[model samples]
Target chain A: MNIIMSKTITYLQRVEFGDCDPAGIVWFPNFFRWIDAASRHFFIECGVPPWHETEKTTGVIGTPLVDTHARFVKTASYGDVLHVRVHVAEWRDKSFVQRYRIERVNPDKTGDEMTLIMECEEVRIFAARREDGAGIRALPIPAEIRALCS
Target chain B: MNIIMSKTITYLQRVEFGDCDPAGIVWFPNFFRWIDAASRHFFIECGVPPWHETEKTTGVIGTPLVDTHARFVKTASYGDVLHVRVHVAEWRDKSFVQRYRIERVNPDKTGDEMTLIMECEEVRIFAARREDGAGIRALPIPAEIRALCS
Candidate 1:
């Protein structure tokens, strides 16, 4: 797999205080949430509008993480400006693979320069429903949207 | 799999308001974290101090979740007294599986009368390590300790 550098995509988010764990570093689990949120945003940026805008949509639903792999390279703390770059590496029959590279953008000494915090890949199954409870299942990527991901 | 109605393992935790998303239910992702913490406690109750007390001895350093299968049986609200129940169902050379059920206990519905809210099962792999990260591999269940899990 060719490593795509940060220059390819434009998804960025500032780490919020809530993202940190008792240890002060961003909890390992929250990274998945941040990247997932950004991936939702990246697609919306690609014209899907399905991520953070989820609650507002009239009948829109969400995609749930089916499989996720992350390797924590560095620690991320509260107040860190995380420059997250995302890309769709593979499009499957009813699911797709989203890759994420999270970096701490603020400069410091050991903490200064942009340090690679984590490299992760997550597979999410999409769903569409509006009700009290729902399950995420694989569905065909609409022709209009599949083209954008391609 | 035979269903087991087990005792509720109460782990007191402060609600991190960030656990909720815009819709207000504890964001689905955080439920997995709570499951993790409770699962660790269950192991400790079985006489396995994750990483074997971290400093005294070393066998497996960490037992992180490798795969998770969860059903959002119900929605859980934020700041609720989450009554979590855990059961060890299967064990393997490198990993073990446990089922978790979480519920919102009501004052009126005390003891076995609490309503069931959510259930999740997470599969975790064990490791042995230290603060600086040092451990070999998952050791076999020590005979003395294995007795408690029964």
Candidate 2:
């Protein structure tokens, strides 16, 4: 039996003071910023060309998120280092589901125990410039790109 | 027949140069920031005291998001003024749904049309400090607070 497994990549982020809210916890929105970066990094590490380079031939400018669902499991403050594990959970004709698991190392003298901070699943599409040049439209998933990422 | 209506409020935000990403459009995460502010403003405009004030009496510090779903409909850039319409979509025992609709005034000669930029629905809980004071936990929906918001 051939076993097919999705590729996963880990992205690291350090929480900054400015990322916290008045309650001294991560402002929540910053998690989305890191998730976006991790999504890009996952493709880069998987041997996919940068969107700008691919746009020349594929007309794929970038992945634009259409829908997202996120759950905040724990609160994090500044000075915390987070590990974001990203993978493609599902692939459709014109879009894909990118999933992220964000964790923080245990602080209570535990041995490398990782505590989940947040998890997110986003539906995004390869977007191209519209004919009118005013906005963007989704493109079908590129076969070569999908093979590389998968 | 007696009918009860939930209060709705509109919060305005002005996009700044720093809010845009390298793509020259507003970074997606900033939408969450504006949505959060709008969530808070909704309660304030409805006559609910600030979280800090309520913390003393009700032990409710703030509404923390547990889950969220968002859809991006249009792209926005700097100098655009967005209006976020927010209201409580549902009220559960320990959690509630806060909905936001972000829109921008039509830039074309099309008389004051509002273009939908993004929409989000969040499941949030009224949180209070845990007994250990190390974290937060959800509290029952306070009737007075709900009455004020509704």
Candidate 3:
């Protein structure tokens, strides 16, 4: 079987004072915010059209997360710059797996040294307005969009 | 082996305007924030003192999440009232599993009927300041705290 490596995209994020909790560390939920942004950046970088544009043609609203698993590795504080590396780990019939590795860039490093802060994996589906208009429904992976991302 | 059933605690949360995303649904990360608060409320309702008070005697700072897995079942928007039911699912030597079931309260319902919104399971550790004070370290589950919670 031919193995195709998924393209990796890196998104930059800066830890702000409001992102930290009373512990003085970046509150864990903020990591999810950055990861969500990174997920969008990955698709945009891969040349996929914005969801609004795609919606006109395919009725696709957006990719919505259905499940997620995360592990907190190290703590981060305000003033730290984080690099969120993201990619599509796997593709399924109606859903896909997106993975992220967040790292803090250390200025004192001799070169390009960074510390791993957190890691997350999420299952998301391309959603469209439901028939009754009450909610959203998953759509099969779009061939054109998948081709662009893969 | 003997089994002990943990006391279940429910925390109330109201969806705020800022909690919703452009899709008009609760941004997924905000769910984690509510779950975290519910986790703390579980201990408090179970007769455990606040972390600040426990810190003085046991050096236990707080229960910090180490790993978490969550599944989003339904969408929620502002004006929705959520009931977050939380409980300790399992106890380990250094870490414990917390489970949460978030449901949306519907006024039209006859009784306590509610709609399921999300489910989450988290692994957290009782943490204390490390000797070097660089970061937190997991402490053995405090027997007294465990006794109270269980």
Best by lDDT: 2
Model 2, runs deviating above 4 Å:
A109-112, B1-4, B109-112
TM-score, ranked from best to worst: 3, 2, 1
**Model 1 / residue A139 / CA error / Å:** 12
Candidate 3 reaches a DockQ of 0.79
Q: Give per-residue CA lDDT, model 2, range B1-150, as digits (tens).
A: 977677889999999999986556788998998998999999999988998899899998888889999999999889898999999999999999999999997768767689899999999999898888677889999999888888
lDDT of 2 by residue, A51-134 (tens): 889889899888989999999999988888999999999999999999999999776785768989999999999988888876
Quality of model 1 by C-alpha lDDT: 0.63
lDDT of each: 0.63, 0.91, 0.90
Off by over 4 Å in 3: A110-112, B1-3, B110-112
In candidate 2, which residue pairs get closer than 3 Å at backbone N, Cα or C atoms, i.e. clash? Answer: none
lDDT by residue for model 3 over A44-139, one digit each (tens)? Answer: 999988888888898887898999999999989899999999999999999999999999999795876999988999999999888887778999
Q: Which is the leading candidate under DockQ?
A: 3
Write one digit per residue (lDDT tens) for candidate 3, span B59-143: 8778888999999999988999999999989899999999999999986868768989999999999988788877789999999
Q: On a 0 to 100 scale, what is the lDDT of residue A97 in model 2?
A: 98
Query: Which candidate ranks first by TM-score, i.e. highest?
Result: 3
Listed per prediction, chain B TM-scores read 0.73, 0.94, 0.94
Candidate 3: the clashing residue pairs are none
